[model samples]
Target: MASSAELHQRRSAAVARGVSSMIPSYVSTAGGGTMTDVDGREWIDFAAGIAVTNVGNAAPRVVEAVQAQVERFTHTCFMIAPYEQYVAVCEELAALTPGDFDKRSALFSSGAEAVENAVKIARHATGRPAVVVFDHAYHGRTNLTMALTAKVMPYKQGFGPFAGEIYRVAMSYPLRDGRSGAAAAAYAIGQIEKTVGAVNVAAVLIEPIQGEGGFVVPAEGFLPAIAAWSRAAGAVFIADEIQTGFCRTGEWFASTHEGIEPDLITTAKGIAGGLPLAAVTGRAEIMDSVHPGGLGGTYGGNPIACAAALATIETMRELDLAAAARHIESVARPRLEALAAKHPAIGEVRGRGAMLALEVVIPGEDTAAGPAPDAVLTAAVAKAAHELGLLLLTCGTYGNVIRLLPPLIISDDELDRGLSLLEQAFASSL
Candidate 1:
């Protein structure tokens, strides 16, 4: 096997510079929370391919299903030559997604496409022009989604002129705003009502638990209140569950935790056990509102990806990964909380189930005034972890959060080892 250094040297000459890699090494194989690089170095994976491998890397059932699918066929876009796997996957989505009402789903190749279509459906159904988004929200990188996302650098930077009529509102960030859930909701509601009139709004889109934006879990009552407001205003309530869906947050979807059934839910990351598959599941009426030809891409809902999705869903249910996510939280939260207590640089430990994060900040800041973000220190800690062979990720609008997205199937011993390495990283970086 080629050393990572040699591979990287070759890659620099071949791969596009704009395409960035978090880990410098090339992976040779991975399964169940661990990966081996081309150089034969082993790593305890906590990123889970950015939460896409909730069923674990190359899960047996998923591998078998994909192999069978490959033997049968690969492509045959659902739009042209429809397949049973596509229909079956949609049926499973309807059954699994939140909301007791009749739900319909549209399969796509990525989260951005799901989100973009959800917005289109919302706009078409409501006959409205404006869409509302919250601060620190990350929808996607597509032109329309870039307009919806809050971050400026990398995602949105140099990518304009973006889609218009998108309005930004306040998010119920408990750590930053120091407001109660209801108060935060009220504040956001006030902003929407004033900036984008309720009569003209098509959708109120938000991540039930923000991803990439620091795993900022809003306070209790925030999401429900927002959903109620959207309903009363006749706007679609869209939950961008692309990152928090599946069993990542100990629930089929994070909106269920708040008991909020969004009119539209966009899902992707963990849906297909790491295969490229995404979906928009919503109330049948709103979903069907779009014209038959209005929503679909040539490669949308490819048969092989659909097959993988079915197997992934089966694996999630068969293994009860939601309970596993809760178990991960039970084991990891206290350790992270203790780490926070010991390290002054660690401002807060937040998030749910297996989707958790530690917000790194300047030490000794006034508690009432909000600690300042320390992105440099956060990067240093991440670098230290990487050197120690722990694959972790950093996120946040301010880039000061160490987010952990360990696979639900990871062993407790691996979690402990990762945590120990993380602690050492923090200590050494500080």
Candidate 2:
């Protein structure tokens, strides 16, 4: 077998330059919280494939279901020959997502597609063109979603001209913006009313807990306020739970934590236990607004992916992985807090459940001025963790937040070891 270095050389020649990876080591196998690279090195996985494999890398149920499904059938194209697995996954989504109303869902091949369809549904249902998003939000990389996204350097630099009528507003980032949740929401709503005219808005889309935008949890009352306002304005409130869905956030959906029921929810990532399945689930009326042939792709809801999703959801319930995520937070958050107390470079420790983060900053004496983002230090620490056999991921608009997205099923021993390596990495980097 080719070594990591050899594979990396081939990858450099073959893969597109726009596509990037967190690490160079090619994985041979993975299960629970650990992965073995082709070179025979074991790594404690803290990234969870950017929070895709919430059930772990090789969950038995997911594995068995996929194997069985591949044998039965791979793809019949749900658009052509609709299957039970597809409808079953949608049923699970309707039951699991944060809503008590009659709901419906449409499956897609990627998160971007789900977000796009959500916007399409909102527009079709409301007959409005304007979509409102937040600062530091990351919807996706597609043309419409790229316009919805707020970052510039890597995700959106020179990627325009993007879709129009997507308005960006201030998000309730308590660390940087000192306003309370209500105050922040008022400001955002004011901005929308003044600039975009809420009457003209089709949707107010946001992440329940911002993911690639630095795990920025909007302050208390922020989400609920936004949802309420969206409803009053006759705009669909979309919670992009793509990263925080499933058991990653200690709840089936993060919006539940805020006690807000979004009109539409876009989900992927952890939904199918690493399978390429995404969904746009919403109220029945809104979802039905589109024509019969509107919301589907050739590979949308493939049988194998749908089967994996069913197994993944079943495994989550059987294990009560939402509780497991809370357990992980109980074990990991205090340790992270202690590390922050020790290292001034750790400007903040935030996030919930297994989805936690440490915002790296340049230490300064003035506490009121706020710490400056230290992307260089963040990169160094991640590199150190990788060298120590711990896989880490970094994100944020500033590129300074070290996000920890461990599988909900990660064992205590693996979690502790990964945290220990993280501390050592910080020590070396700082």
Clashing pairs in 2: none
Q: Candidate 1: where is the Cα deviation over 4 Å?
A: 366-369
TM-scores for candidates 1 onward, in order: 0.98, 0.98
Per-residue CA lDDT of model 1 for 193-290, tens digit only, reads: 99889999999999999998889999999999999999999999999999999999999899999898989999999999889999999999999998
| lDDT per residue (tens digit) for residues 1-430 in model 2 | 9999999999999999999888889999999899999999999999999999999987899999999999998998998988999999999999998878999999998999999999999999999999999999999999999999999879899989999999999999888888899999999999999999988999999998999899999999998999999999999999999999998989999999978888999999998899999999989999999998988999999898899999999999999999999999999999999999999889899998989999988887334524578889999999999999999899998899999999999999999999999999999987
Clashing pairs in 1: none
lDDT (CA) per prediction? 0.93, 0.93
Per model, state how many residue pairs clash: 0, 0
Lowest-scoring 10 consecutive residues by lDDT in candidate 1? Answer: 363-372
